[model samples]
Target chain A: MSTAHTPDRPEDGRDDDPQDRAPEHGHAPGHDQDDRAGYKTDADAGSVDERDEADAPAVDPAAENAEGGEPAARVELPEEQQGEQEIPTFDLTLQIRRYNPEVSDEVHWDEFKLTMYGTDRVLDALHKVKWEIDGSLSFRRSCAHGVCGSDAMRINGQNRLACKVLLKDLDLSKPVTVEPIKGLPCEKDLIVDMEPFFQSYREIMPFLVAGGNEPTMERYQSQEDRARFDDTTKCILCAACTSSCPVFWTDGQYFGPAAIVNAHRFIFDSRDDAGDLRLEILNDKEGVWRCRTTFNCTEACPRGIQVTKAIAEVKNAILSRSM
Target chain B: MSTPLKASISVPRSKDLEVNGVKYNRSSSRRNNFEMYAWLFMRLSGVVLLVLVFVHLWVNLVSPEGGVEAVDFAFVAGKWASPFWQVFDMLLLWLAMLHGTNGLRVIIDDYAERDRTRFWLKVFLFTTSAFVILLGTLVIFTFEPCPAGADPALLASFCAAG
Candidate 1:
């Protein structure tokens, strides 16, 4: 099942063209105010400021004791504590690559500046734009807390999940550049055809194989044996690691990091009987040898799988079997 | 672009392939330490080359009577006369060729797309490497510093002195 959480368009906010605005480093005047933050005009500004002060603790005793009761230190703690669900709002420009095959001939960038919470994720900003500011903006996201790997995109030139990257973690001084992940054919705005990636995943045969009679109880495994391949078990098939790899970018047929990692999960499993077959599959010319050990996959994996290390292990397995 | 793939729920068929009513491991003819030895040789030779190359440079250039300019026919002839220097030169020649050939082979395997292309490229590489190695070995061992009938003026100063 696909969970593409794209909102339907509202009629009124569609008229204000984001393209007409200056691409300068100022507040996104009309749109950000209209969206989530509900940033007020000059007349209503006082009430918003009053509400912020009321929500925050008037004084932090630890800050006063640690800093000799400096007034500035007391003021900073409230802002620091704002990230704890209170979400201090800040102006951010979400520079998104927009493409519609039916409408536009080529992809063009569209910037939406909005007053967003420090607690807000990149997906939240996209949701705000689609829900309140402009309805035509589209992206894919599911299990918005990063479990489902649907929202993998290049945020600031690195593969990351939209739901995983917080606005506070980003450099708000520059526009947050959100584009589709590289090494895949971008189908539309912030979405690529994942079939090619999944095709590679399928070729690896990521599952267990036991060549024995059905056990009355589950086949027992020692804690150490389970721990051996435990790191690779977190793969969500996100393609973040694969798309980030320079080798996979150059050679599409190379079984990318995710596939090898999944293969490693079974290859090292003590219960699996088909490991030799898996190793032989990976021993092809376009297999583990193609990995340059760039560590880009290790960096991009949201589930924190040690992708390069797993690839190395698979290479060792092939080496042992071949020799 | 084609349609985005739906999430996979199909059960893994890990036991599909069978032989003679029983499962069997895939057969592979290559059962040797060729790659393992090559990889080990690269690392081991790298450490040895680091010291040997630096020391050879120092003796021939920096620490000699004159840096770089002291490297003439007489300088090489004098060094090769010693058994220590001959063995040193031989090790340098062998290690460098083997290390370099293996490194290039890795690059070829990484970049070459077609099977025949990779095979031919590696064949060419191995052929050239073997030629250079043999030629270098012959030159290192059979090098003539002084000929008996050579003109005295053209011969190295050692020949005239001896």
Candidate 2:
């Protein structure tokens, strides 16, 4: 569970402001600035200046030579290019499902219309509603770009990370509907009680279980052996795939696709010793056989993990009685 | 004036039912991958079934014998007289029965939510399938076009003449 940490220092080219924390997971650098500038400028004159500054040369030797080599790059360009570089914005109506268990017994839809650019995500729309229009809007989100696995809600009746789904991908002709994921109990607006989801995940030991004498050096595993279970490693435990399952909805006790996916991660690992034990656990009546292969889990995975195929391989492993 | 409630995630539940902790009894049959093999068999047999079915259709319905009208008892008798045709038909009968049965099993598993319902449905399916396959195989191999019994009037006109 120990992650490799790179200590923060002033010389590391990272900003000191906590608000400007570096993008650690999936988002490219400078995306936060683009989104912020998009919101602030509303595609106005301010955006044009920013674009012009971005495109202008950083080290212009000819201009510097002309000004006695005294840093001509510091001089601002003429305002003509600034006029052409405009950020486009359009109005989008987000129909969000609102629920507060203490306040109400039923879920309700609240619509918020906001101006956003093409590059903005569904998470941005939720933020605009929470920060500007209604302070009472409640939801869970961290690492706003797709990594934290939080903010997995139903967007247009499909499970997706609010941060991962681009506004452009949705049909703007209709108001986009957002709700809590199906099959899990909704505790509040867009947030389900994740205890049951995590409970199933806990049943399958997600970590490596190695036995025998501790190796003096690192345990050697071939590239081909590592490649066997490579696809299952990308799981962020978002529960998007699991929640979308028809089997999980039908039988709550059934270990859903996510748990099987995690089991596949270690069950096929060449270095692990508990593969047989794990296989035996999955061999239960409610195990791999319960997967009817309707392919809802595969389609719902945001990480693009081949969930159904992994389950099939696990089924094969159980059959062959091999790891 | 009110103090802010601490924002903390809920503690995870203990794994009381993990492998070693609980007596994990399997409710379903212990046999593994009968379904797995069944799934794979469907695909592999489907390829074979495609070939066998097309050839059988061409010989009986389309080729020489023009259509459904040509497929009388005499035509069936002529085909079954040859060992090659009898064996061809036996293979076809077994493959088609097994393939169709596996497909129905998949459907039952998907649509039938109740275990007892699925079990009974599959029981009916397997029984009927076994009956058909056995009966078809028996008739294909042991069919006597002209039986020794004295029932010439009840037999096909060609069989009675022969």
Candidate 3:
């Protein structure tokens, strides 16, 4: 069984063009991964090193297909070249980003192996590796049931919750590797810095503004009014939607999916009195205009939030106000 | 006896204070006040940055030789030789990093669901930014391109002329 779960795209409001907008800041990042955030990453050593010599296979990053020494992405085995390992269980490999500042090239890949059922989730195997094999193998997860919006990482070529995805869901005959969500800072071992992500969120002021009128009782919002902003509110703040965004990956300044989603929550709210002010904040150099509409965030959001639809709502608000 | 003695790197995973085996408890008062202060910061820093940014532009862009010609390796050397430019650059670096990072901190709070992710990611962001700022300040002050080197040709134009 494979652990990868292809995200369902039923046509919400997600942007289809992640590469449409040009980055205004001219922040060119060398795709070398090593040049990221000034971390010294070993281009040679496989990122994942299992401290525990267990039944796990050495599946950090899969073998490169010999393209200029860059690690080759592992292709799904065609059922014939798989299950060759005679170990009692499976060998799903993982490749994670690692960084040490005092060194050069702050990005590199590490690998690890874990025995599993075809139906096992990527998160289960990670727990096993962290507990039994490598104590230092780090990734973020909480509410293992997927409610809390943690454990957002890139499995194979997509962003997902290690807890929510089942190995059986993917083509498990081949090794499955994991990395931190793209478009953000990789702190170390499958983690990325989120302060920039949060800055965008807070910049939108994801809150209620009771217009200048001060009523006696609490602000009353009709259920339909509330429901208008409800789906947007489903954001657990997991950056899966944002990091899956390639535009965010290049420029750390973009407001991103979740930020616009939060803005939608207020912009469409009947109670918010300061739509113009909020829009002004987003109009700055690194505002909503930077979004190139990559559906990656919608595809990666585990909560099934309609990321692009929400972004559209924000744009509509801005346009309506400017007119 | 078999354990390797590598320098233990302590990455405070969530930066959530842990004292005596318990997570640091926060008072509601502080959280409410934190928002107030954050609001204050955005306004104040926005104002200060306006001044700093324009002043910075004036110094570099509105100067002689259309500004570019006046700036050279020796120009940089001369600027840092005084305490004024050092302080100015230092302020710009710190304020920019802090303003940008604080902006990020707010965004993160608006997203990142799990406490662990928030804690660890912030720890990473804070540490990295702090480290860069610290290193940048050091370089700005102590940079010595010609440290009594044998290559006199590369010496400052002023030194050669004198």
Candidate 4:
């Protein structure tokens, strides 16, 4: 009888009639165990029927007799699958650094207390505050996942993606501090001017520059050559690696790790012919040489790109080409 | 409905932004290989200094009979008496000074924001480094370990013998 309950069931509650039990259990009217099992119907049918009776929910005799049939079987669902499962939730406090030049010249910290679920991320908490508590809370985010790279911010002094950082992983005993990524102008709360980061990106010529005619079909590349630049291709221009840099914090002119990583992508592509021009561009004083190899960029990259290693490779390329 | 508030202030785009009162101007490339050579020199000299400095320390301090206490006027005089020792000390002095100066030069370039401030700081650094290097070279070659007019007790034991 346990086999009577097929996994397929109409999600809508249309089959709730007490008389509709036959089709509800995947059986036609008058279909016996022999017809249903199709194999060992003679030997095991009685035991299956007994177990099915025992597993059925306890029903009031009066209600059953009054209705002239057993009530719909209420199958006990697992704890996690139950629609009414109690999700663990807790009160989360977010201390956000608020800066609005229009409001005032002074920067202040705003605290927001929100009830959030265990599975909720820092981005969820921010959304809760924005949607429910205060609509004035401002920040930039897209895709709501790690891919778009739009929600990169500082969580407790380290650069991280808000959407990627789950609330449970953070130290919830204290207020989670959320602030804007440093070394860029903070236009408002959590939003910074991204033009400088993109300017540096533009300086490196972050595109394929082939001298010959464009390929008719596609430029063919070996697997090994593709694999060489595969790591840097994951960059979403998040600027997390660049802002976390101490050198970039001082000098905005420095190409920063993101630009160099983008350059590394095309530099080792094996098809691009403008490697020399790129090398000359990055050979500037404010170029790859400014990278102090602090490993901050490596730690801050949400995409897990090896930023310092790429910068070092560029430096090595410059050295080899020059010498 | 409440009217939207107009922004009383505006921030310049990042390319035109100022950090620490200095405009964001990337110094154009000089089209020279000076920085590359300086960077290479730091790495090479760092490795060489590791050997040179440790050997110098071991000979003067750790290898002596009484460690640091064994170092005196006579010990220094004995070491400088040899041409090989003179050349070794000279090389150490030059490399170390230049290495330190270049490291500081990079730091000044990194930190000092204003053009005039960077210029003055680098000028001061170069002048001081040049003075020390020149003075150190002169002392290594022209050091009179056993001056004739000095008190015999203050001089090295070899001076009394002479």
Candidate 5:
């Protein structure tokens, strides 16, 4: 549960230490001020000159020495650039459900207040808490961008990737409730045991199985054929869709939506020859028949796959093959 | 003052997690088309039941001169006197009961966590369904509107006309 303390810094050459940085001037550096000054005439001459004086840069020798023998780079930046434009920040409150059986069998909600930027996501808010407030506030996240699919959780009662949901998009007027996805065993705060979900995925035989000899060159498929299963191919193995299912929450034996979606990916592929076997696997007592077509999986999918439709298609495929 | 933390703690691994009090194992494939037929039967019977149920309701409740009040023992006896009405009622009784039994069986399988519980529930469901279906079929076909030497006051007026 321990996270490495890696402070995120802006990619621009800006110093983290406030004292080493220059004072703030409201406007952008030289480029933006020049564009604004172009609209002014002789009547605004005095105000323009006053603004120019405020833009003048001052270098500190002590700051230069502290920067490890490098010249004072602060003097080179237009005074406006020295201090970046104030990213409009607002106070955000996150109420996270914390569970650790080792400490206590009872799960409790922990609240955190953070100053987050308008562009910051729920993942950023969590990072601020984990990095600055409490290092023990654990959650799974890799590739802070949305691709890794590591940080799917229930944000304010809906399943979503923490990295993909912007703070501004949420109703920040209320405290955002962050809980582990439902129907999975919670290992710790915001982390669910994904093994059962993955087991269902593995049961479906996710990879393509073609019976013929391997193609000498790449197995070419028409674009039309590729497009058939293309929507399901975007699955990153995030359990968001499966955990949201009401049936999955109750009937654990059922192969969940993600597994069926993964099965759909390979089942419809024109090149794969094992469609019959996969259909047989899904035609069990706990298979597509168990799906109530609730559309919860469709709504919860971060990859935007039409999960209910895919399950229906599989049902049709099974019926056609058997009956 | 803060309490001292435990020196060591045991956390269960993800693989050790049990769902619904049992470790997740896919149910053994029955390798039969029973569930497929059952599923299809639900859909097909559902459509047929919609028509059968509405028509039955209209004939009994809406079409009669006094509506529901006009429906009495004599009315039912008169309707069952015809073979067409007999067959229609039989179809309604069988399809509705089977449809309901199958639906309840699926629900029991879904909600019942224990195998014994599911088994007993389905057993109860099938037994009751069979009883009703058998009794209903017998009543529909073998029912006689009039019997010999029945009390004149107890008999419906239509029986006296015959």
Candidate 6:
């Protein structure tokens, strides 16, 4: 539950005002020209930030106090790239999490100033960073069209596939911060370890079980039957839905949304008579019961898969005691 | 200091279900295997669903015969008359329901954070899905397509053949 405090102050390296009392949580040094601290209560942000917004960074003072005592320490802290550097020429700025396990001592964010079309995607920015700025920056990518579902990452506190998110759709005034997915261990940069994710995935017996002898020839099925599970069939195994889940961050064992989306693909097959066995498997404590339905998966899904709908279908199957 | 017991128990089944050639162990989390397999089921079923779904779409809406209007009670009876359609429909029913329910399971876990709330919500979800799946399966396999001494219009084309 405890997070390591990240020492990497904001790009605008300004320290605490030193005038107002520093609360329990360390005030994050952000870009601002004021002497006031952003350490007020969450409720005070409206009143306090109202006067400080133009001159200071966009932050709620009281919001920081609630988390209490400094940023959670990440294995890699934000670097103290302090003091004013020459702001680069660009129509926009990109603050991306940079890591090269082979070279760098630790992962850190690197800001880039670029002149890009409004419709460019995070993937485009990353491509620019890798090719023009730093080839050492690593991330997974395939089927640049987004169908491969490989480029999923946390964008501005939300998990999304990089190829699918258009940069222009984001708030431009602030630096577009990006990081690897939360919960799983970081592999290189922007890629989390997926072993545990797959462990939960492969556990559900992803196969067709008719409960009878396996059919040598094609198994029989009707048209009406196929139409029912049509929607769940679109999942592309991308971890976007899974990483979007908050519970997944705390408990690595909790089966996440993408894994369940995969299971849903099979559980609905009529030719597979393994309902009893499948139900028994899914009935576990961390099974279908862990989803809190924040709609994050649905929002983050790159395939436009009706993730919530599929989850509903699975819930219906689990709640039915016949299993 | 009291350390929690790390003991585990498992049920031995005839054929172990595995995904991606990996065996599913229910012991690690000390949690039930319910959600684990539900996640797996989505992937597995999603695969088979690709085939079952395509053929189904091809037969129902894309065939040379008239579409949409050709479906009705009598149409259902006609299709059920063939064991192929019966088995196919049954598979679709089971997979879709299970897939759908597993998806809902994730929703429950994500949204229903409280213990009591999760428990009751799952109770309700399991009960309803079980009831529907049971009734549906029973109707599929044991469906009677004919009635004796009934209105000629209501009977199947071959109902009076007996």
Query: Which candidate should be chosen as best, given DockQ against the real structure?
Result: 5
TM-score of each: 0.69, 0.69, 0.48, 0.78, 0.77, 0.49
Better of 1 and 5 by TM-score: 5
For A107-180, candidate 5 gives per-residue lDDT tens digits of 99999988886446788899889999989888999866555689999999999988766675677788999999
User: Which parts of model 3 are misplaced by more than 4 Å?
Assistant: A1-91, A100-106, A212-217, B1-162
Worst 10 residues of 3 chain B by lDDT: B23-32
Kindly list the per-residue Cα lDDT of model 2 for residues A1-323, writing each as its tens digit: 00001112122332332212322323422232232122222233344434434544442222222212111111122222223344345677899999997998887899888888644678889988999999898888976765568888899999888886767556777898999887777778888777767776776767776766668788889999998988798788889998899867654556789989999999999988767767766775567877888898877776667899999999888878732
Q: Which of the predicted structures, 1 or 3, would earn the higher TM-score when compared with the native?
A: 1
Find the 10 residues in a row with the least total lDDT in model 1 chain A: A1-10
Query: Model 4: runs farther than 4 Å from truth?
Result: A1-83, B1-25, B156-162
On residues A1-323, what C-alpha lDDT tens digit does candidate 4 reach at each position? 11213222222342342222332212221122121122222244355445434534553222332212211222222223234344457776899999998989899999988887644678889998889988988999986656578999999899998876767566777899999999888889999988778878887778776655566778899999999988898888989999999888885778899999999999998988767777877887778877888899988887667899999999999999877
Put down candidate 1 lDDT per residue, B1-162, tens digits, no spaces: 222222323323243333332212212224344555565577789999999999988888899776898787778887888889999999999899999998999887667655578799999999999999999889888989897777776566778877
Fnat of candidate 4, please?
A: 0.25
Residues B1-162 of candidate 6: C-alpha lDDT, one tens digit per residue: 222121222333234334443333333344464455565578799998889888888777677267866666666788899999999988988898888887786677566645478779889998999999999999998888875566767666887676
The A-chain TM-scores of all the candidates are 0.75, 0.75, 0.68, 0.74, 0.74, 0.67
lDDT of 3 by residue, B48-144 (tens): 8889998988887677465766766656776676788889889888888888888787566546645578788899889988998999989987877
Query: What tens-digit string does per-residue lDDT give for candidate 1 at A1-323?
Result: 00010012122232242221211212221122121232234444445434433533443222222222111211111211212244247888889999988897788999888998644668889999999998988788876655578999999999998876767667778899999988777778888877657766776777666755668778899999999988888788889999998866653556789889999999999988778777766776556766878899988887667789999998788777765
| Residue B41 miss distance in model 6 (angstroms) | 26
Q: Second chain of candidate 6: TM-score? A: 0.73
Tens digits of lDDT, candidate 5, B22-45: 555655545577888999999999
What TM-score results for chain B in every one of the models?
A: 0.77, 0.72, 0.67, 0.82, 0.82, 0.73
lDDT of each: 0.69, 0.69, 0.60, 0.74, 0.73, 0.63
Off by over 4 Å in 1: A1-86, B1-45, B81-87, B101-138, B147-158
Residues B1-162, candidate 4, lDDT per residue (tens digit)? 222222321212233546646345455545567777888999999999999999999999899899999887878888898999999999999999999999999999889866789999999999999999999999999999998787776677778777
DockQ-superior candidate, 3 or 6: 6
Name the weakest run of 10 consecutive residues (lDDT summed) in model 2 chain A. A1-10
Candidate 2, DockQ score (0 to 1): 0.11
